[model samples]
Target: MKEKLFRWVVKHRKPIIAFYAVAALVCLFLRQFVGVNYDITSYLPDEAASTVALNTMGDEFEGDIPNCRVMVPNVSIAQALKYKDKIKKVDGVEEVLWLDDAADIDQPLATQDKDTVETYYKKNNALFTVTVNSEKEIEATDAIRDIVGDEGAITGSAMSNALATTSTEQQISIITVAVIAIIFVILVITTTSWAEPILVLLGLGVSVFINWGTNLIFGEISFVTNSAGSILQVAIALDFSVFLLHRFNEERGRHGSVAEDMVQSCCLSSVAVFSSGCTVCIGFIALAAMQFKIGPDLGLALAKGIAISLVSVFTFVPSMFVQFDGFVQKSQHRPFVPPLGKFARLVLKVCIPAAVVILAVVYPARVASTSSDITYYYGTSHIFGSDTRLGQDMDKVKEVFGNSDTYVVLVPRGEVSEEQALSNELKALPEVKSIQSYVDVASPYIPTGMAEKDTLDLVEGEHHSRLVLTVTAPYEGPSTFKLVKKIRCIADKHYPGKAMLAGEGVSTTDLKDTITVDKGKVDLIAVVAVFAVLLLATKSLSLPIILVLVIETSIWINFAAPLYTGMHEFFLAYLIVSSIQLGVAVDYGILIADRYREDRVTMHKREALLETMEACTIPVLTSGSVLLISGFLIHAISSHGVLKQIGWFLGVGVSISLVAVLFALPGFLYVLDGLIGKTTLKAHFLPKDAQDPVSDTTEASAADGSAQ
Candidate 1:
């Protein structure tokens, strides 16, 4: 069956090439339909406090939690009121609150309360808490910016999301070009034929483009998925092509014709290709199980991209290689890379010592990794540097307003007396800077009957009354999370199960809780799935255990590094890197072990180990270098917080994984060859008849404590 398929593929090489060409055009055209969602808060589970509160607010009230705040500095009361009205009139601006709503702006400035007045208008600046529809954020913010030109500064959750989406999308375009250029240079230095690199890129690039087009099925993906998915596809796609090229070139002279060699290569490469790809897919597929929607969003996209790249490599790559045979053949140069035989010997000599050192430190690394300081907030304020406009605007607001956020507490409208009592209790709390409700404002200043219809409507909904609490806490952190819990406790005490809270603090708490559950679940799922794949491929019960152990050690150290450095990693990055590094980086170990297994059939242990290292070293180093550089490059180039953390983790992870696979795995294999030989199916760990000759140097080294 395999022979027939390969024969047909080569026979119809031109037609196969033409099919991908047309598919590429169709995929490119389909790219416009894939939408991007930027709001991380929207990914919260339905049962979370913020999500429930948000839903109830949507049904019961015309307004939502404030998402944007625009400050027009140096404006008179009348001018500020005029500016507020203009902003309110803008399309998509649902509700705008200025000083007039809280304290009568018409009153004399001397008689009006100073703290109340200064909350909205202070230091000749008027700050407006604008509730804008998330879908219309860009349109509304742009129009509001037009209203308050040079003197206005805008920052809030809405504006932060808009900036995050726009900037990340832009950075992806720039980084894709840089990544491609660097990958091409790496391939050139490693590959004997220059055209092979071009073919590999074209083959893989088309797959990534098609992966984007395929996202139309998802309707919309998170901006995080769209930002990171394509680059990862490009990087991982090379793994499949690298193994195929190696198999093809290695089998070139033994076969009668190029087509025969290509077919033989495909057959020989199948186990490695599927094993590696399956492990990577398992890693991504585990993410789809996360309670956080971004997990599914990113997981499905990345898993799909990996599957598509695998198919493209096996089918499209073979066709391209055959069709462009003369071009690829003539472009061949001497491979600039060489097998470091001396280095392999040295690594083998210290294998036992290095393994001992790794074992001694790995436990400490695992403990520290679990204790890493993780931040859950996705706000661009924390992500972007203070020099950025978003960060500056946030700092400016905190400096003036004393670092506060507004949470809308919803409860059944019982009576003005009860509501007022609830409001007063809430206002008395140290965290509660102020409170705004119909009971708080209407009774003291304007009678309910005399209040303007719009102002009254903002506070009173059909089934619920809204108390907007101004709390002295930043957007998200331990303090804000604690504040949210305390406020929820108070609201529940007054109106249990009837009251709901909506704000960034509540949302961040939900995000933190949701991801905390997924971290363990994802780890378990990935390990089990990848272990099954490794077990089936190697047909050895013990091989999978050893490989997972070595790779997992690398992961422990990767996450633990953040603790030593005092960098509070984004919480999602740990789960992401753990799965990615375990599944993806384990391929290096797989290659080494598989080669060692094959070579042991004909040669003694040390001879086979040397040959395996020499054959496996170039591809592993090339692919590992590509992945590591791309990781650090993304970390360096991307301004997005999540991407930066993910990039840094990936860079560090791949480097550690490389060291383990190259140095540590060989040691384990040498020491445990008897176990592997006894356990692996068909038993290829030793030469036939159990007596293979070793070189004098290798024999002398073995006598010095190589075998137990």
Candidate 2:
């Protein structure tokens, strides 16, 4: 069956090539009409908890709910009040709630007994909360700059349509330029011909379009994020191109004719390439199981992108390679020995000791340094810097507001009949800085002529009530978790069976706690799943164990380095480390294992190991170097601490995995050969009579005669 399929592909190569060319062109043209969306919210399903909460809040609230908050420094209360009217007039703004104004009511307002309104007002900085109805209403952030008008520094909790658009555009631009530059560098290094990487990148460009076009057929989901998806696609697509070229070179070294070599190379490499692609695609597929909407959306996008890359590699790559066959054949080789020989030797000398040191130092260090704080992943620069608006405003707000950390208390109207009583009890809690509720706003001091009242007449009946409390400390670190627990305890004591916390800050804190508790479980599941696949692929229990050790070592080293760097967001780091270790590192193990088995059929065990390392080293190094460099370049465009940490860790991990595969795996294999006592390594299940009979000797003699 395999022989028939191979013969059929060879016979119909021209038509197959033409079909893919047309498909690529059509996809490219269709892409001109498509646009990519990067909104994080887009990843959530319409009914997901976060999305549902946002929608529910949007419906219940009379005014717009601010998504982006701004704080202006060095502004007087009077000066800030003057801009309120101007800010209200800004396009897309639904309402601007200023501290200086209160709407009149027909009924008397209730008064607070705990703290006088005057005292409360004096303690809190006067703030203007501007809210916009939609991003589409205001296309650019210039509208915001216009409203502020260079006046006394203006800042407040405000969502602007303009800012979102600008940020998205900036992110896209950065990713595009970075991907192009990295591809250029990779092309220069791998092919040494200026045109080769260019062609490969061109193929990648086509693949992106194909991915986009096919996604439309699948129903327009959220556009893949430029930062994660676009960059990842380029890196992954290049891997396929690298595999194709590497195999082409291998075939040309044995077969005399470029045309015949192309067919053989495609047949041999396609199996490994497709398998590697499946592993990557499956790594992403695991994201589908994530409860978060973004996780599944990312999974789908990556899965699609991997599929497109596989198709393009099989079709678009082969066409380009065939076109450049003569040029590829003419490229000179210096025949310098691969470093894997020395690396294998070094591994023999140091494998056990290095493994011992890694286990003793790196594993414990990683465990000790793991933290639950998500903000650390965002980095100190992004958290405190004034470059981005969020950073700038967060700094001002933190200073003026004391701490921007907030908590929410939800009360059931069944038990809590009097709003004042609930507010009073919550205020007495040590963690509560200030409370904002309809009941507090309706207090007599807010409307001096009104009398004090215990009940809110306007909002009556069994509706759920909410209290917005500002916490004393910043909403980061271990203390926040403790505060959340304490708040829950306070709620249980006072408003038993009637209250729950529901707000961005509270929900986020809960998520952090949940992730922390489930970290080990999730990691264990992912690792086991990946290991099962590796065992099936290699069909050797010892090999899978060796691969897992290499991967775990890489993950530990990758994670441990962040502790020294002062980067402590363990969850994101763990996700990234695990994914890369499983996806990219596994490819290296497969390459070496496949080569070792192939050589075992003809050579002595030691010679087979050495020759396998020699045959596979260049391709492994080429692919690994490209991935490492591209990942490292992610930091150049992103000041976001999480991205930088990921870039650094992933880059380092890929490089380290390359080293382990070249040294540790070979060393382990040699040790295994010694133990197994002359047992033959099993070759991959290939069809009989499908092997290429061409030899290096025959090709070399033909090349020498041609030169003469």
TM-score of each: 0.94, 0.80
Name the runs in model 1 displaced over 4 angstroms.
109-114, 146-151, 372-381, 444-451, 687-708
Per-residue CA lDDT of model 2 for 588-665, tens digit only, reads: 777777667666655555556666766677667767776787677765555444455566676788888887777667
Cα RMSDs, all models: 3.9, 6.3
Candidate 1 pairs with clashing backbones? none
Report the poorest 10 consecutive residues by lDDT, candidate 2.
Answer: 375-384
After the best TM-score superposition of candidate 2, give how far the Cα of residue 211 lies from its true spot, in angstroms: 2.3
Off by over 4 Å in 2: 1-7, 10-18, 21-55, 72-78, 101-125, 134-142, 149-165, 192-195, 216-224, 253-259, 323-389, 405-418, 443-462, 470-475, 489-500, 674-708
Highest TM-score against the true fold, candidate: 1
lDDT of 1 by residue, 328-432 (tens): 999989968776788778877987777776788789888888873633444434776676677777777777776767799998874677678788889778888
lDDT of 2 at 366: 57
The local lDDT score (0 to 100) that residue 490 gets in candidate 1 is: 88
Model 2, 518: alpha-carbon shift in Å?
A: 5.8
